[model samples]
Target: MKGVSTIQSFRVYKHGLKRLIQALGTEYVNLQNVYERLLVGIAPSHRIEAMIDDPFGELWREAQLLGRLRLRLWRSFKNFEDTVHDMREAVQEMMEKLGIGPDGEVEWIEHTSIRRQYKRVSFILQRSNYHDLLTRIREGVSSLQNMAIMNVNMESDRILRSQVRLNQLVNVTSNNIYHALRSTMTCRCQRLHEVGLRLTPPSRTIVPQDSDDDVIKELQFRLIISHMGPLATPSVRQWSEVLLQSARSQVREEPTTPLATKSSSSKKSVKFSVRSSVSSTNEFMQASAIIQPATATFSLGSAAMPVDSGMPQQIRDLCETMQTTEKRRSGDNCGHIQDHMSAKPSEYGVYFMDCLGDCENYVLVPLKDVLRDQSNGTLPPMLYSDKLRLAWVIACSVLQMQETPWIPSCPTHDDFYVVQKGGVPQYQNGFVLKHLPDRGGPGSTSTSTTSSARPTLLSLGIILIELILGQPLESLQPQDTPASQLSPSYEAANKFLGRVNMLGDLGISAPCNVVSVRYLKARTRRVS
Candidate 1:
């Protein structure tokens, strides 16, 4: 009004002040109307003029702040969305390559035993692939964790930058608008007083103000929906790393002492004992070395050492009896103990298979050493049949005999098949399991009954079948047959001997080589 001419004021007074409003101070409008409209925030949407000629408009500053706020929010949301998408893709690829289920099941091997045997090179290639994929998976876990932290930091930086911008814009705009409003309003108030008129300010009704709180709540809601908790690495990978690291810790030196060293006279002979149990459910396949002079030998552990493993206790006892520092160290030895002997029960853990933690295989003693012992001169021609017969003898001696033919608690097989490191075989991941006593009935205990050597007869028959057919009784069963029909060792023994009995009566000669026939005849004469 001070800048406006008297004609303009008369025109404004006659018409209305709405058309003359511009920034904080207007050329043709009074500052009182502009201040009241901006502060109370009930202004009309229509602009007074086509352009904001002055830069000190409070309404314009509010709109600019809001627009920039919206753009910052949009950018933050987009960045979060992209991070989520990339993380999802990375996790998906990790799951596929690692062959792990969401529920933490590991694919033990993609190839079956037969497939690995037949396609050796292909299996090797797959193993290499698996190794690399495993390495990537481990690396990815660490990388993903770092990325989560990085994203959180970046998002925090973005919000802080936007906050700085908002503060800067708000500060400049507020100062300019405040000074302009004061200058213009003071002049108008003085003119109105000179005209003998009093300017009465309207009483603004104080309503409950919650706009700032509401804006903060909306931001919090957005943050909650876009949180990065879901981006954590899968638990399977975490548990698997635990297993891998645990296996690495189990690596130890193999015992290189021989089984038959004479001990010093000062040590007392400690008689070691065994716990025996037979299993009908498990089918054990001997290594090919079982039949050769390079027989299955033992080393203390393969990968894991039991905290209270009976193996160590028995080894101590063995050392006492032998009176030597090294007790029954495995390379090759006499065929004294055939079956594996453990104070507690044991199963053979697969080489790499168990390192992942499935851990459900049987263990064996160093009968290969005994076979090597037999391979020496002056021992009988324990060829294919003799080797098996000796195994049968050793199995019987370990089970029913209660004799300490083999003094060691754990048994082992030569891991010549495994890749050697620094010229020594890995043996800490090792143990020995003895042959189970042939059970008497469907629910019979592993302990042999006092009844006549009927178990021995049936076992001999099964052994005969094994030597003649060169296959397991279970393997000989008709394909597609239920295991229940041929269940338990007793049932197999009955079936095996029955067929052999018929073959003998029919003068079929029971299919034998000269050495086997001679050995059988001599043994039969001795028994009869």
Candidate 2:
């Protein structure tokens, strides 16, 4: 119907459009597959899942539109030349959606799913070869017009292999049972009715299924009670008989669980430790499957520590009490399963303070500014007793069950502004307290253990060390040229310790044999 040249040009353009659609469709399918793998495979709490959600969602929309455009391309054949023009415009639009710059580069800040996925994969795999993987994918897209069918198939196979390897890496990187259990040791442990406060909605008969979410929750409650001790409940004497019967059941089920009735059983029990040996190499360990009642140990101290070791009274009393109480414990549906106490800090228990709360509102100032007028001369050295006093407070708060006495957390010079009111330091004297976090007092939990205090102790320790050293822990980063060789906080304390011969091999010091840095070092080591 037309000249030979015109017919040939239309054919060339139509084939080009076919190649473009095929190439894009392959990419779209692969991207979708990888995203679906991540969405359902990972744990809900993992940060990587949250980071990928938006980018992957955007990619879904783009792919859907591209598919619609590809379908519309066929109807345009009615206008011959117009069909080729429409196809070119659609191709350009898809390319623009990819956010390629005029220079043919993707910006890192654009939050493109491809780039972020590459980053997430690289991070999880502990490798950085994703850049190459991304480049190859881009090159495959660019070569659509000329690339052989064999080449396209080969590229797709390689990308798929990378995706499978990434999934394998994720599985390989999950936490072991011991580590995983320890991480969630202080997490909220509630009963089926306790959390949702209902038995009728997710309706239950008098009989519940043997395998259910409730069963897992029951296992969790027993586990917490095994360590934290039972809260006060009415009819203690009646509860004693129930607990006694439960203990017999546990002993019968897990043959390794010793009978506490026998006085000779102490040596037979597996010793507890701060870092317990993991049960086995299973990918995901259930608390009910691996958690043994006798092995229940709290953090903050050594394992195999004796009862008379002078630990905090509450923790010591708690551990000793639980040792006896749990030995008489029952099965999945036994002792002390009521919501007598709530674990939600904000609701019933105290909500502990956050250190870097609303980081945007904080203002950084040098330490010297606040203490300019505190001393007669160049600020007198802070008393050794003061350091000891502060360190002990944090140590006890962290290690103890209940706070013995409320420890006053003080502000360091560089950290906050000071307003003195008639020789007292507080806002009452006119010191402006800005951007301070509300450290709500801890309320009750399923177990009102010292778990809340643990985080406080760790963070407070860092603050105290910085105050004593008169420098930030992260200040030595500049000197460590091979940065990765040294830890984030270079041991600045060791340098001073070495000078004073604290670590044994005496190097340099006043040799005065007078001033006692011994007390300070002892306190620091104990706190650390």
Candidate 3:
């Protein structure tokens, strides 16, 4: 209700008081309201109006007021946003410093932060194009280095410089991203199994025995499969099957032949057919029935069987004693000591086979050394072929009696052609088996029984010659044996016995030219 001047003055005074409170106290003020407060501070005089009238002065005054208001608002939010940005940058820098992977992306493996937040940070980093960014950064660095070397004009270089700077910044940022990715990519898996991985071995420097390329390859396959991802190498299963089948083939024993004998071939085919048909059955039996008889025999000239001329007197003496006892007792008298002596059984015939190399085609043989098991414990025994048992010798031989007549026929008179003839020639080398009685004369009814028993025959004449002769059979005697049987002296017995059985089978023929004892001494010498 006062005059306009008086009302204005009072209003100005009220504005001044508000401005003072806003400046000195923690009161809030908006821009539009603050202008009145500023205007109130100005003296209500023509002097203030004169200053405002200057060029652009009114706009400047408004801007100043607006800026102050904006600054006040910005101050309130400053720490909240800046602190958040600083923490984010720190985390990103940490990720870059550590080398982890998805090669170029941040994997969760690297983090210094508390474990709980690592996965969360990694997820954010994954969305970043780490690889592309890093590539650009490297390109930018190259450009900067080139620009620095060229030193071009400012105007022209100015653009280049700006481009270089921008690229450098981009590159630096990208590098930081890449480093973060590398650190995070480190493997955090505690166990290989967790990742379905195996450990693959590196190549070895030394080779072991029997380690051929194929074998080494197979071993490598297995080792890699067990160590690395198991699914990566499946060749191991195929290799195992092949090795097993080869072992199975080696165990089958038969005379050496090119096509496995046709009969055996047929049998094998049949077995495969049967196996395919039923999957399981008596495969060996069915196969064996299909093969032809494995051996053959032939009859040569029927000669009179050899007689035991030396034992005739002993046999006669035993018969006489038995008769004398019966006569003295009239059927109840006991036999006298002489009668028992006459009845004493002679030791089984000790036949010899010519083992001399030249005498029987000089075939080399391999024999298994005998090992005796005793009740006390296993006695240490050396094998003939082993270095520890130098004194022992093992030899194998086969006797061909029909071809070599010097070999004497024994009680079991069946020819050896049935069991050995068709095999490899080496299998038919001369052998003298001992301890068989002489068979009865050919006309005897019991002769057939003796043939069924095992044959024990010898090339005793040829062996005696080797005993008498010091020279090897090949040089000193004929390959063929003498047709006529001759009685050998005790001197022959003393010869040809080194501690070892060099000529395993006695089919070895002795040289006819040497003295028996001399050959005997030679045989006694241990082979070095």
CA-lDDT, candidates in order: 0.27, 0.27, 0.24
Q: Identify the runs in model 3 with alpha carbons over 4 angstroms from their true place.
A: 1-423, 426-442, 445-494, 497-528
Candidate 2: give its CA RMSD in angstroms: 28.0
lDDT (tens digit, per residue) of candidate 3 on 1-528 = 445554454445334333322331221112112223323332244434433332112332333332232222222223322332332233233235323221223244334433333334334334242334323323433333333233222224433333343333322322222222122223322322100011122212211121232222112110000011123432211100000000112222332321121122221111111112242223322321211121111111111112222331212222122222212322121211111111221111111111121112322221111111111223233222331111110011112121112122331111111111122222212222211111233232122232311222222222323322322222332336353312223232333333113545223322222224444444467343
lDDT of 1 at 520: 54
**Looking at candidate 1, what is the lDDT of residue 171?**
28
- List, residue by residue over 246-338, the lDDT tens digit for candidate 1: 111222455233211222333221111111111200111111101111111211112222222222221111101211212223211111111
Where does model 1 exceed 4 Å of error?
Answer: 1-388, 391-460, 488-528
lDDT of 2 by residue, 1-528 (tens): 345554464445334433433444464344333333333322234633442333222232232222222222222212322322233344333334433233333332334443353443233222132234334444433333222233333444543443343322222211121112222223232311000000001111111112232221111100111222234531121111111111112211222221112122221111111111132112111111111111221111111111121211211121223324434323212121111112311001001111211112322223334234233344454444543443343332222211211122222223233222233332211111111011223331112233332333233444445434434444533574475633322143334433334423221122211112443455478799
Give lDDT for model 2: 0.27
Error of 3 at 271 (Å): 52
The CA lDDT at 218 in model 2 is: 18
Report per-prediction Cα RMSD to one decimal. 45.7, 28.0, 47.4
